[model samples]
Target: MKGFLEDANYSIGLLDEGATLADIIDNCIYEHTHTGKRAFYVGDLGKLVKKNTQWQNVMAPIKPFYPVKCNSTPGVLEILGTLGIGFACSNKSEMVLVQDLGISPENIIYTSPCKQASQIKYAAKTGINIMTCDSDIELKKIARSHPNAKLLLHIATEDITADEEMNMKFGTTLKNCRHLMECAKEFGIQIVGVKFHISSTCKDLQTYIHAISDARCVFDMAEEFGFKMNILDIGGGFTGSELQLEEVNHVIRPLLDVYFPKESGVNVIAEPGCYYVSSAFTLAVNIIAKKTECDKLLPSGVEQARDDEPVFTYYINDGVYGSFASKLSEKLNTTPEVHKKYKEDEPLFTSSLWGPSCDELDQIVENCLLPELSVGDWLIFANMGSGTLGEQSTFNDYQRPLIYYMMSFSDWDEMQDAGIASDTLMKNFFFVPSCIQLGSEDRFSTAA
Candidate 1:
């Protein structure tokens, strides 16, 4: 029951030796662009699969529950489902999306702390008993609607200094954790675990140590109340950097072993959103227009301009309102790389990139050096899989980008060999008539 990309197509090919991601993007754009929309490589999902495998290896006994709100692309979700990872949904629609993918209700956690009465009722109706709450009012709502629910009290971490402070909006403080747990107890609710997010893009691993310590305190309290705390939901704030994750693991692994030991029967899980999908997607943008600003001088000795500095302003098809919404929402700065290979002597210049919108706030990059590019040339940004497409808007009549899923022919073979790919997935692997289709006819034998 997985969803498929309706208008999209795929091809099998051996990527050229030493071909960079830029090369792959150039080929896709050259072959696929009709009206100049963005392209997404579904093959990138393989990278995520690898990451999940690595996460499992590094932190065994700690399962990963991908946050659907990060990148709800059906293809991404389908791939994760095939990999046997669970999902962390925020709303009823997201829950329905995961359920439609044939994932069981047990594999999904409604992670949103503040829920509407209707959403709570929907979760109850769908038999999604696992949910999170941070406040007393939410506890009351859950008690009235789904007292049978397994609750995870989200504890707020202190002095969070990350790029995005999730605690500012959600999570209860350590002092308030007891009251919420007490309220849940009063309502005869099942408090099964504790949860906390240090913050999104957290740089300080110390916050994780503190938060886990706080969760341990809550576990002790729950035990005192005769409740068997069996789940420790460490909410996600991971950026997909191996070194960073390793550093985090260095701290978390020991903590889990000590606080929630294997013999303790605690099921540890995480709601990772960006970590799984961010590095899997690349965004290719077409430069639609360009303008050069030269210093202008005025009359008399006032000297309006002293030096003639050249600055190029390039307008791209995708902007803040489109696929680059992360620029505004997450304060994410994407470094743009030109698609063409430049010679050693090729000149570079300081330039700014803008989106296709008329709004002044549609700027993407402000004062960066890039190889001189033309209106038709393509510029790509990597690690754009998360926090971008899901929040895109169609403002100013600019259509959203068309995502192109890609996979190396070898990886496709592996997926088929592993029996992880569905019949629908295999059937949808075809070349667009107008685009370049690689491999021999036998390679596309199932395309018909």
Candidate 2:
């Protein structure tokens, strides 16, 4: 946490006791209106601490290696590093980022299946020996660049999802696993384990049963070749849902006991990207412009609507090209709560939110009922920390919004209880006073 304090790239605001997240957001919104409104993010660092505790309770024994590509916010990395979680880096820059935080080389795994040769050399020089590879080209690259590299054979478990799209992008088939093992043997690369990913879109928990079963098969095959297979990576598909996590755990725990029992000396890990960060941050975007039409048909693709009703199109400062970039692949959970209070009796109308880029593709929220808001009013989108910052593609001189990191005193205490008592961590504990005046007219938004 202290590393990012002086780094100028991030700003963390420590909240006083009872100083709610909404208070900080209220203060920020008040200040922004005085100057001019721009999009900004409020990250509740306390949520990360809570999520870590939840992970420990539910997903114990299976260590978590956070994929840095998901949301590489410095504050997130700092907090997760402090929690002693291993990192799954995909490139040299990510590896360097974690190592700079004093992470041991063994605590990091280079996860780029198709890594660049120079980056592979960089990992070799830096002692990042654990890496994932799926094909002979990758094995050859690792062998030539870093012969001592330990490899996790990235196997594409039979894609049972409706699209089977994720497997096509990475992972070698089970049949190809033998050939990959043979190639590693020829190239003198160390094939140490197996790794597979289940897309978040995959609903079937049976997929885990099949994938874990496939991994066991590979481990058995490794015995014939004399390669000691130890690690089993049940890769990312976790969607910040407690029931889903518990459900998945219930299915996998028994299978793990049956296949790779405790005495097997196998280390189990999962790459959880969104599970840790998504619900921890909120984005605040201002309504930059507005247009209203009466008795007109609503937008075509928007989900909810009433025909021949008033429709409003709101242009926000940030859009799909910026903070909401995740909208490209996954749907945006962008039904924002209005930032300004209004009467409960105020009529709601079908509204569409768009970006200032003026591109028709820049729509943020397709269709939702919103209180008719003025251009200067703000909107708050919760659960935005899931790779939104890392996925942004800014256009039209749009600067990346400043992230305001926040943590409650109780959470800070809990973090200490969790055994992160590094002296440097307290250096940047800039606590705010509990009694903050949130202006005369507006304080914070709520159900109206």
Candidate 3:
């Protein structure tokens, strides 16, 4: 264990010095006898901070409220909290999680349109009065349970070009908005704002323009009802892509200027889930087994070998039931890259990657070309921080991948200079130990 600690420390030192991810993985494997099946690089949390800074620069008037459901990795949440980003929680448990991180109730927005009676009571008791509703029935429930609640009517905006359309599940139509508002008035509930989601992976910037236009119509109606609506909740659909976000800002900024100008005294906030954490994580999986179809024999007493093409199947430890759950839930197609590179002339074979589970549906990738790989080879997948970590379960009693928390050396220095205790930060916000301490004397020593 002591020897492994020394090795981990060396690898972390390299990472602090900005070593390549592939090099860090190689070093980790060499040092730790019990290297886990999958590893998460928490240092990439810096990327999320940078993204948020970019968002602030592009949309200075708009505030971002991170949806905790996207990737509730403690380290990710900790970094986001440190950056002073607000949170959008969907349920009572989610609300509790954010509050436990020392976030105040005012910093949370309950974005889930549907809620159980008990959950509504809990929110009210916890001072989380800012909530969302889409139907008359929900409004009535909120009125009976928490009449003083401030509400944002969720409007469903369909985006024909979105990869996932959320309109099917939630959002109130413009025609129904006035009725819901009137119902809120009858029940003495406050209608504070309007909210809409174009759905995840939304590609149409025009959808925002249309949604905002529709929201304006509702805003005017609220005025006629003698309600002062001060908030506009632009529900999340940002994809974290620089070009796509820039395009969205380019179109929506001008529209907001015209319709919901700063002088209008309206506060604009967004529920961005994937935008903050999507590219901030990297997953590393190790090949545990390999089989070549060409090595098998046919029933007709003929070998399956083919001179023209060779097919291979590789098995990895993490599967669809675990870290890859997003593939099914989010329709994400993950592409793996081998850690080591081969020469251009090196022969490659058609390959399919599968999880270690017995279920045949646990395939990762199919009909891809990769150089002939052996067991113990490492495969890295990027853009894994969103909707991946929090969904992992211990199905079949298989342990989930171990995560290693880290930050850029400069950020670490800055935090230290600010007198932030690493122990407190890890204990309060991160479930995993810091990579800097994981393989150091602090981890193994019995006393200070």
Candidate 4:
């Protein structure tokens, strides 16, 4: 609590531990008011870097091309950009975002199969010629739009009942993959390689091996078609936490090296969006209110609410509609559990945390088991903004939350000039001119 976070409302430093959560909240609101932005502590993009480094290590022998769509937060993107990872973008907009970040065109692969002619033309014009296609129709489209573009034939991975399963869409069948390659040959597009996605948060490991084997078979098929594949873009599905990248790498690297030898010049690539940002930051909130319920004996002897027990409710300031969208799991709910400060004979109890928004369904945790939390107590939303919020766009009258970085002021200022800011700056700074386009004539100066 010793750093100054700035925004339009005001710049404030961290206070002593004696300070109340209310005070911190008030200061944040104040900073937002003055700076017209809430200054978050972004002294350094620590959380993201740590996670990305872990991912880089774990995906060793297999290069990572962070999916820009996962969390295009400037902080996350800048950190990944500095790390020199390639990008896996699905649309022209993301391609534009990568360009604006000064990411080289060669480091980007346009992986969306059903893109517009303009997107394909833009990708080729910008020298970002590596693209993906799943059908002969798409191959023809790329051929017609960008004859010299290099393309990866996407092979759909079968869905596994694991946590990470990206099979909702994309990729072509073996026959279609071959057809696409042959069609590419007819159109003069470079058939560079093949790729697959194992869906994010997948639980099984061997599925990846199987998917790779399937890809290798497709490579053989492509080779039969006179196409020499140089890459195997295994879409990322490493499901371990950020801290376990090294462990994951140790387990998967040998498998990959043995299966897809580098002597063959067939490099490996991964599209990891969740791995680089998840677990980097926590969403800490205070319990603003609590409620209890009483049960009455129904019809016969069955007690509904029991004796004096009550259903406690802890309301915080964030919710599923905002940054906690991923927790919804296709439904709006959170599994909030409570832990006690000290070991007690009472054991652990449970409760629910609700968001501050007025929506009736704005609950964070449904019924979490905890050590009886009280009003004014704080709880941490582990892996909220870094992982979930990044994918959320405004929808259904819900807005994303303001980021709150916890860091020092001098560092915040330095980053601000460098086009980076703390969460507080995101909360406050609205006047700083952002570079909207890279390589655009308007942003560059004319030289003699």
Best by TM-score: 2
Cα lDDT for residue 311, candidate 4: 60
lDDT of 3 by residue, 325-443 (tens): 76664565458888777899988889998878867788878678899999878788878777776646667765566555444555555555655434546342221223434355323
Task: Give the true-structure RMSD of model 4.
Answer: 9.7
Off by over 4 Å in 3: 1-15, 18-20, 31-43, 162-168, 295-297, 300-308, 413-448
Instruction: Choose 2 or 4, whichever is better by lDDT.
Output: 2
TM per candidate comes to 0.87, 0.91, 0.86, 0.71
Best by lDDT: 2
Ordered by lDDT, highest first, the candidates read 2, 1, 3, 4
Worst 10 residues of 1 by lDDT: 439-448
Q: Kindly report the root-mean-square deviation of model 3 from the true structure over all alpha carbons.
A: 5.0
Range of the 10 consecutive residues with the lowest summed lDDT in candidate 2: 1-10
Question: What C-alpha lDDT, on a 0 to 100 scale, does residue 448 get in candidate 1?
Answer: 23
Cα lDDT tens digits, model 1, 35-145, are 344433423555766787678777666789999988887777877887788999999988998898789999999988679889989999999999998888989999999
* Winner of 3 and 4 under lDDT: 3
* Model 4: CA > 4 A from native: 1-44, 55-58, 162-167, 240-255, 286-306, 313-316, 330-350, 354-363, 370-378, 391-399, 406-448
Q: Residue-wise lDDT of candidate 4 within 1-448, one digit each (tens)?
A: 2222112133223223343333334444444334333112222244455555466455666778988766666655655676667898988878887787788988999988689999899988898988888888788888888888888888877665644343356777876776676677777778888888876445556667777788878878777778777988978765436544555565557767776787888998888776666554444455656665433323556566434555666666556666666655543222432322456576455577776665677776676666666765556444443345444534454434454433233334544565544453345322211222333442211111
